[model samples]
Target: MNIQELLVTGTRLLKEKEIPTPRLDSEVLLANRLSKDRVYFLSHGDERVLPEVERSFLQDIQRRSRLEPVAYITGKKEFMGLELEVDPHVLIPRPDTEILVEAAMDMLKEKTGFVHVLDIGTGSGAIAISLTRYLPQVKVTAVDIDPHALKTAKKNADKMGVADRIQFVWSDCFQNVEGIFDAIVSNPPYIDREEMKGLDANVVEFEPVKALYGGEDGLDFYREIARQAPGHLKKGGSSSLRSGVPRPRRSEGSWKKSVLDP
Candidate 1:
């Protein structure tokens, strides 16, 4: 079938499954399968898709209908203008996290001299790599408990040409992280047990659980970060926690502010 016909068929299949954004999803999947931009379809509607390509596109449509994320299907997610690799091993980067990154950039820019930052659970290196990419004065130590996630983050850092500036550590929270920093940032797993149960299949089934669950109150990682941040942050330094919860209970020591994602 032609591009237009194939997209219509794909969209119908997704719509039958009650998937939101069916048309956009169909277009994205087809564009990825063809290694062409979606805009290509607008002008080349009559162009026929190869039989092999059509079959693969149909498979992707089936997966999306099953609630698989487009990012996981395409193996890439664009965050902060950077197209980063993603898989089931790491949490997919979302648009909301860009606010946290911007907050970090502002905080780092205010500090004088070379600044060191710490990124807890730097899945896909979205936060850490973004900071290094935009803020030249900062170097980041990004740690994660999952080595697989770390590997993925490392590859992203290398791809973004920020590998030299980011030190990927295999540490759960701050257990293995050393030294203090001018700032600390994290988009930790903050979905509570109950919340996890209600999540859409796109997340609950496809995304990594360790990257989503946050104990009973959805504040376990916040507690851990608060408890450990004082030891790892410089005097008057800041830490931003991007989670569903508001600010965490303050741990004693020097803290400027906590930027929480509402």
Candidate 2:
């Protein structure tokens, strides 16, 4: 079908499936598939899509209709202007996460020396990669419990050119991580059972549960991180936990500040 016709049909299908931002979603999926800018569709409105490409594109649309994330379908996501590879085994990096990274940077900006950082549950290695990218003087060790997620994070680190700087460790919280860090940063799963039920169908159905649900009280990871931060951090080092407060609603990515010095 032609560009206009394909977009119209795809948008209609997604709208019927109750997908939010149907037009934007259709545009991104098609453009990313074709390796063209979103504006390409408007410029080539009458151009026809190949039958095979159309089939693939339509399959992606159907997946989104089922509430599967667009980032997972595309296998890529942008965080802090860095394009990182992603998959279902890891959670897609969110914009709010950049805040935590920025917070860490702000605190470390004036060190005038090398520092060690620990990134917990380092899915896709966004935070670790960003820190290493911007702070060449510093070294990072990223830890994740899931083997699959750690593999995904390592792949991203390699692609982002910081694989050598990050040490990937398989650890449940801090059970296996060793040594002291200048700071500990983590965005662990913090959803309770009640919060899980209210998450968007996309998150609840498609995202990994262990990466989202904290425990019965949602503060399980926080408490665990808090319990371990002291033993693992150097003097003046603090743990930054990405707050999962205000439940699973739209305003969810806000950081809840917790300062612990050891």
Q: What is every candidate's alpha-carbon RMSD to the true fold?
A: 3.7, 3.6
Q: Write the per-residue lDDT of candidate 2 for residues 1-262, one digit (tens) a residue.
A: 9888888988999999989899999998998888998988777999989998899899999999999999999999999989899988899998878998999888878676888999999988999999999999778989888899899889988988888899999988887888999989998888888888889988878888899998886877876676667778898886666775564342122223333232
lDDT of 1 by residue, 75-193 (tens): 99999999999999999998889999998898789999889999999989999999999998889999999999999999999999999999999998998998999999999888877
- What is the lDDT of every predicted structure here? 0.88, 0.85
lDDT of 1 at 250: 35
Error of 2 at 165 (Å): 0.7
Model 2 RMSD vs true structure? 3.6
Query: Once superposed on the true structure, which residue ranges of model 2 sit more than 4 Å away at CA?
Result: 247-262
Which numbered prediction scores highest in TM-score against the true structure?
1
